[model samples]
Every structure is written in structure tokens, then in C-alpha cells.
Target: DGPLARLRDRNQLDRADKARNFALAQAGEKYRECFFRAGLDPLRTLDPSQEVKSAFSPNGLWRCESQIENLQKFRAAREAIPEDFREPLAAIVLEDREIVDVGREIGAYKDAKMAGAVALFILRRGLTALARHYRLISPTGAV
Candidate 1:
């Protein structure tokens, strides 16, 4: 694969793995929030799409998506609620938000978790941006 293609594959893999990770994390966060209402330090962990990443299954996010597909029951629920109610969508938006944040944060921080679009985007914008900078400074100049 070309560098971009490899990056895309890894990032897509990471996104898929992260979908699973974020689902479980948010679920645990939800359970934990029930008691303390979301403290400062959220948990962090690696992705789980590799051959031997972990023994435990990573299916919670898929399950969560399946569970949430029942929102058809609320097709009219939005009309019933008052205008002051905060939430607008029936689904969690973290995925897209993180995707967009990837472009933004990577442009700024150069290596931050917030960059989460295509796998290549993550490679350039998230963990590898600093390395990219150094590589650019080397003989290649980002060829």
C-alpha cells in the first residue's frame, strides 16, 4: 500500500476499533456518571482491531448501536418535548465530532487524539504529526 493507503487502513481500523472502544468507554462513563456526574479524568486506552490486541471481545459498541436503533419509537418524541430541552439528535454525535476535531486539532496540536477522520488523517494529524514534521525537515521534505 502507498503511505496514504496504509494510513487510511490503519485509521479506518482504529475508527472501527475506537467505535467499539468509545462505546464501552461511554457506557462505563455513563454508569460512573450516574454516581459522580463525570469527573475530570476520563479513561484512555488503545484500539482493538489487531490480530492479538486482547482476549476480551470488543462488541459493546455494536451492541449499543443495535440497541439504539429502536429510536423509531421516538420519531414524534421530539414534538412532545419542550423547546428548552437541550439535546437535538436521537443519536450520539461523538463519532462525527471527533472526526471533525481530528482535522482541527491536528492542524493545531499536530499530535492529539482529537484527530479522528480517515486512518491517514489520524496518522498525519494525531500521533504522527510530530514525526511528520521531523521527516519534512529531513532530506525528503515531505515527498
Candidate 2:
């Protein structure tokens, strides 16, 4: 019983180490900053036990048509952005095209810097559109 208990402890320690390393590797500075600002622990969030859902879930959004619909909307919105707003955005798409391309490939490394950059672009554009919808920003994208 003692030997078995020791083995279990070692296995748990190994798993915890692996999870920590994986979390650290995946959680870039942007993600860490966001987590810190939100008062959340990035490490705990990466734990498998704390993971809310599995990729194989039958009801997961990625497995549904709604996901495709949402992606289409995202694409349309991206395409609809005015030239002025696109000027600032061009730097990211142009400089980090490879990174963004890889990030978009399969949603792999969700917290990667490249993925975060792409997400940031979407979020900034979404906010711009939302502000426009409310008339908070001009059509030229000025606040």
C-alpha cells in the first residue's frame, strides 16, 4: 500500500508538471496579461479536469453548422471593413502572415501569439463595427 501510494504521488506530480509546462508554452504574454487583468489563473484554467468541454463533444460548436455560419459572418464582416480601418490592420496581416496563416489552419495552439494577433484583429474590428452601429464612431472609423 505504501509503495502504491508513492507511485501514485509521483504520477500526479509528473502530470502536474506536464500540465504546467504545456500551459506555460501555450499561454503567451497577451493571454497571461488578459488572465491577470481578469483575476484568473492561467495555469488552473489549462488543467484537463478544469477544461469545460472536450473537443470530441457531440454538442460542441465546432461540430455544428452554427459554427460554419458564424465563421461566414466573421468573414463577411472582415471583408466589409472600410479602407481607413484596413490601413492599420494591414501591418499585422502583412508582417505576420505566416503566423496568422498557421494559427488559422486548425485553431491549433489557441493561446499562441499568432492566434492572439488574429483574435485581436477580429475583436478590434468587431468593436469598431459595434461602435459604428451605435453611432459612437464615424464611418471612417474615428471615435
Q: What is the TM-score of each candidate against the true structure?
A: 0.17, 0.27
**TM-score, cand. 1:** 0.17
Residue-level lDDT of model 1, residues 64-88, one tens digit each, is: 4332332222222223323322121
Give the Å shift of residue 59 in candidate 1: 45
> What is the number of backbone collisions in each predicted candidate, taken in the order shown?
3, 0
Badly placed stretches (over 4 Å) of model 1 are 1-25, 28-98, 107-143
Error of 2 at 103 (Å): 7.3
Over the full model, what C-alpha lDDT does candidate 2 score relative to the true structure?
0.38
Q: Whole-model Cα lDDT per candidate?
A: 0.29, 0.38
Give the worst 10-residue stretch by lDDT in candidate 2.
23-32
